[model samples]
Target: MNERDILIVGGGIFGAAVAYELARHGLGERVLVLERLQPAAGATSRAAALLTMVRDDPGQIALARQTFRTMAELEQELGEDIGRRTVGALHAAPASHLAVLQARAEVAAAHGIASTWLDKAEALARAPWLAPESFDHAVFFPDECYVEPYLFATALLRAAIARGVRCEASEVKRVVVDTGRVWGVELADGRRRAASVIVNAAGAWANRLSVDLGLPLPMAPVRSQYWISEPAPIFPRDGAIVLLPAIRAYARPEVGALLFGIRERQPAVADARTLPADLAGFVFDPDDADGWANLAEGADELAPCFPALNTLGIAHYLTGPSNYTPDRQLVVGAAPMIAGLYVASGCNGSGISFAGGVGRLIGELIRGAAPFVDPQPSAPGRRGAFDPYAPDFLAACAAARAGKTSG
Candidate 1:
């Protein structure tokens, strides 16, 4: 029997970030991470990796801002470039939705996140790619940035490994709970491991693990689609991520091309216990080039401001599961009904943006330190059921709440 102080299931951004934070807080040698597949080979690798404070929910905005600071600190301490692009992001709102964006900007500014309103001409001036007629108004988030999700995940994993945290390629079949407290985990091979604490950061498989433990969880998996443009110079060389409120699409300048992806609401399930898992139905791998060619068609519709991307080249296309919640906010903190059990999943598609903050909060919870972000919206009990919300998560919590009921 392998004994450990803490056991972490899953090695995605959430798990890696938590492990890194735990090691930094002095639990490195005593923590064990279990990953059935290679690191970052799960939903974490498919993250859109955009970071912005333009959210309607106060809790999410706070968490995103705090995560931004965490990324800054990690960059300074590790001296490793996480591929952080500091170009500010522009959020364009359709004429009918201008009020919503304006109100969101005010909420963001109140949280110490600076934002400025840009007229259509100003937005076009900054992004000459726009087709010259895309929006009624825009909000410029000067501090918004983007990081390569996979690279960041690897950085956190490396940091954790350096601190003596051990990780193994093994699947966790079940969580062991006795007398309303978590004992540890049970593997598929009839092996049982004991730990003082169990952190379920399993991403899309979170709900299944909780169910195996006989605990209720309000998390589910929602498939999202994204496509990479073939190397092209038509995209902006240097600019912030461009998001259009009217269209559920975004484009960001990467190493040699533009990366575009959007969230779609679809219920999906797959074998959670499998290694090197295949996400067939849950992932929308379009068949023909035109399948993904039309992905950004909304750009021409809503973001006519950036005309450069209207005719970009077709690049490789991929899709993956993005764990979500009824409120679209993450499910963090200790399980209300299961003692000694904690969760850091249900991050939707924004796991990369919130990974740092999630790790810090989990570290605080484990070490009995004061948390910097409030853990209410992300609480497991925030919703009574697993309901799909919006792709723009922050603004969807209220609607998610309206559909909640006591479990």
Candidate 2:
């Protein structure tokens, strides 16, 4: 077996980010990334890619602020365009969330993120499509932006590879463990590679490898689906990303179309073992099997804010599994039962937004450098032993996604 310094088992945003951070710290030659599929081909490919800076947690806010700085440095070093759209974001909710929005706006200002509370007329002026009186309160962040997730993830991996980090198209079925530590990894082809450190960034299939090590991560694959409206004159090419937590929905402009996501009353959850290598073939909705049913379910709450919902042409549907923890935080840090095994899963539907931060944290932790953000809240072993593939655990994870207040 070939000895390695670090072996990351997934090529999605988390794994790619970790590799880039390690390479940035001058450990590229010793790192290797193994992907079952192409980079960003899983959940990363389907992410909404919202970069919301204002959050409930101070740790998350700090992490999010670092994301912008990290991405800016990466782009300059790699000369890659991440397709950033800086139209900003608007949070329109009922009066019930006014104080919460006000508090969050204060948090944003403290972080040097400019935000303003918009009156009804101003809200409609910015988002002419919004129903003027649908929402009682609206907060606008003028500097918020988003990116093309695939390009963002792949750019990070490409930068890492360019800096001597190696990547291969291979699937790691399980980590080779002995003496209470990870020795290496065994691939599906029965090939083994030695690694001093193994980071399980396998995303939806992360738990599959961990469960075999007698350490099932407290996370599950939950379906996150969204619909795109067909191109129309009403939908501007650069409309601001809209957040409506009152009705549990959000929308952004998708090239002259409105791309919206609705949090179903009971979001879909899946057994990680049953997931296909290609998520495109998976069916997320089990009810009427209509992804549009989610829109209908939230129509009552959404219609007031978005009257265009009734007239918009449904264009496309994107569905995939996002690793979700009950607390809706990234599962980072080393696994307690297995030494030298780091875990970074549980994106909670914000992988794109949090990729850079996760990468930096994983890299810092592995390099013995102090982390930019405190890692206590996201420790992987914080939750007790439980089968991630089990139904009750899956429900808990699904509940987290359903109850998520942030993007």
lDDT of 1 by residue, 1-407 (tens): 34466999989999999999999877899889998888888887776688876676777776677678778877887898987887888877668877767776788778877788887777766565555555677888888888888888888888888898889988898898888888888998889888879899988777668865555556555554567767665566675577765655576776667776543332233233331354544433234323444454444453354454456665766667666565567889888777889999877567877888899898998888888888777887565443233233422432342232100
Residue 195 of model 2, lDDT score: 90
Q: What is the per-residue lDDT of model 2 for residues 1-407, given as tens digits with 9 covering 90 to 100? A: 35456999999989999999999889899899999889889888888888888788788887777778878987798776777788888988878878877887888888788998888887767677888777889999987888889888888988999888999999897899999988999999999889989999999988888887878788888888888878887677778888887777888888988888888889889889999899776786667465767777778877777788887778788888998898877788878877889998888888877878888888888888888888988988787776677788889989988887666
The candidate maximizing TM-score is: 2
TM-scores of the candidates in the order shown: 0.86, 0.96
**lDDT of model 2 at residue 148?**
88
Sequence-dependent TM-score of model 2: 0.96
**Candidate 2 local lDDT, residue 396:** 91
Task: Report residue 38 deviation for candidate 1 (angstroms).
Answer: 1.2
State the TM-score for model 1.
0.86
User: lDDT, candidate 2, residue 101?
Assistant: 78
Global lDDT scores for all candidate models: 0.71, 0.84
lDDT of 2 at 282: 78
